[model samples]
Target: MSITPTPRILVLGASGLIGRFVTDDLRQRGCDVVGVARRFSGGQRVSPDDLELPVMAMEASALAELIRARDIGVIVNCLGVLQDGPGSDTGAVHRDFVVRLLSAIRQSRRDVRLIHISIPGNETHDRTAFSTTKREAERLIAASGNPHAILRPGFVIAPSAYGGSAMIRALAALPFELPEKERARPLQPVAVEDIATTIAWLAARPLDDETTKAVTWDIMQPEPVTLGDVIDRFRVAFGTAPQPRITLPKLLLDAGALAGDLISRLGWMSPMRSTAVAELRRGVSGDPQGWISATGIVPKRMSEVVGARGASIQDKWFARLYLVKALMIASLVLFWLVSGFIALVISFPATTAILTSRGWPEAFAVPFAAITSMMDMSIGVLIAFRCTAATGLVAGILLSVGYMAGCAILTPDLWREPLGALVKTGPAIVLMLVALLTLDNR
Candidate 1:
């Protein structure tokens, strides 16, 4: 009796929300899984132990070499980028990277099966950057002559939040009324675990001649629900009271998108971008019968999954704390920027007078005030970014302590003011610490 060899699989973007789940699921099923990413940081949402394979660089040559060395039989590309960031191009990730990877695979002469996770609307005439790039990549894969299964999923609901999922959870948790336009937007939320399981199942199946002809499947839940309905379901799951809906003018949404675009230019991820809003306007959903027929796995309803998961106290805490963390970070940014602006432009005379009153020379006072203001603004900018937030928090703590001590010795009376200017540092320091604790590379 001869034993069939286990298929060696390589999973790209293994640190992301869906990738992490897919990698972990495949590993648990006793498959040899190799996970690759741009970088492997300890601070990713997924714990280090969950990743079976040590994360490697996403370079084409390196990845190809690894595949050859491992004798990989399947390639599951969980890689995707929702928005572009510094040094990370959306077009490159969605289209160019895949092209290079396919070329590398062909050079290796390995008849590896390709499983790609894509979004819906890519097949239509949608001209959005996200949809267009995805469609281009799909076209490249189809023409590559590799055995591929392209799965287009709707809104993937995971326990952890990022990008649009995070935005949905945050908005749902709001105690006030929500925009009516958002309430009417339709969505078919699919569980991340189900998607992961589906990918793992596909990886295990043999690639027959007929199956190798580049098939596409729309993977989503059978039941379709509106955006507002999902929000209410999440609120109930999180042990929160559902708020009433308020119909706001479309102009407000446009203005919000404009603000979101401005923020995106500053290298921050904003969910209210015009493109994102347009995607929401055009519902996210698809037929699930094809996926079911192929995999024989029926996706669970959104409400049932959330209800079961939300029974845990920890889940509720996470749901609530996610928004709290955002608010805390926002507060720190506002405080530091406002304080810096006042010192640099509005309160320069008052600042100089105070410094000179403490027996400091006029020349030193002017330069010191200017330098301090700049430093304050720098801290605000640093804290606003994910990569530099930790450093910013540390700088903020040191500066806060130094300023408090200096104020005590130089201008002790300010501590007793009605507004408690010096006393406010107590809360500010605590807020910075909270923000630091919640910082992640995502």
Candidate 2:
């Protein structure tokens, strides 16, 4: 009896939500998986504390050489960007990267099978960057002579949410009624595990068959559910009562999209951008016959999928606490920035008066106030970034302790204020500590 050798598979975007699962799935099937990403730090090849696959962390220019050196037989392209944010170019990622990758594969002269993950609908007229670029990439893959399989999945639901999935989870967790227009859109949410399993299955399948090449499959759930119905199901899973349905006018949604675009321009990845809104409004349901026929795995209904993976107490708390963390960080940032502005610009008189009342010299007070304001602003900026969060937390703790000590020596009576503003510092310090501990090492 002859034993088939394990195929060497290269998974792009291995750190991503879908990529991680796919990498794990392939590895579990005893395939030799090499995960590739645009960037990896501290001599890290694979994702820290996630997967054990060997990884190549380099630029696109080095991809061909790496593939040839590693003898990768199958390339699973899971790389995708849903939104244009800081350092994220949607067109470049979706279109340019795929073009470069395909060219490299051809140039390397390796018989590599390409499995590309894409969206279902190919609306040529769609102005959304996501749809336009994805379609372009698909066209490139089809044109490339290399054997390839394109899987267009609808709404992919995972254990955790990120990007549009995160927004969907957030909306479902909301206590208020959803906008009527959004409720009308239909979606067939597919489980991430199912998608991963399918990818693994495809990778192991023989690619010598000519008919399977350049084929595209619309991967989705068996039944389509309204957007509103999906949210209601999530609400039930999260142990929340279904809120009353309300229709939001098109005008309001449009206005919100406009505002969201402005926010995105400021570098915040807002889900309400016009492109995202348009995509959501267009709906996400696709024929699943191809997927079922290809893999012989019937996709589960959204209800069954959600029910099996129902939100636990920990999940609910995490969902709610995520919002609380955001609000707390925002509040802290605002408080520090505003306080700095008051001391540095608006209320210098009051600040000087307070310092003078404490018997500080005029020369010392001015520089002292300026330095304090700058330090406050610095702390706020530091806390805003994940990389500098630990530093910021430590600085914040020291600063808070110093301030409390100074207040005890000087304005001790301020602690007795009815607002309990001074008392709140203890909780604020604790919150910062909590955030620091939970910070992502990525």
C-alpha TM-score for every candidate: 0.89, 0.88
**In model 1, which runs have C-alpha deviations exceeding 4 angstroms?**
1-3, 41-60, 241-249, 309-313, 321-327
Checking candidate 2 for backbone clashes, the offending pairs are 180-247, 180-248
Residue range 234-283, candidate 2, lDDT tens digits: 87788675565455577877996787676455455555778788888888
Best by lDDT: 1
lDDT of the structure predicted as candidate 1: 0.76
Stretches of model 2 off by over 4 angstroms after superposition:
1-3, 39-61, 242-272, 383-394, 410-420, 434-442
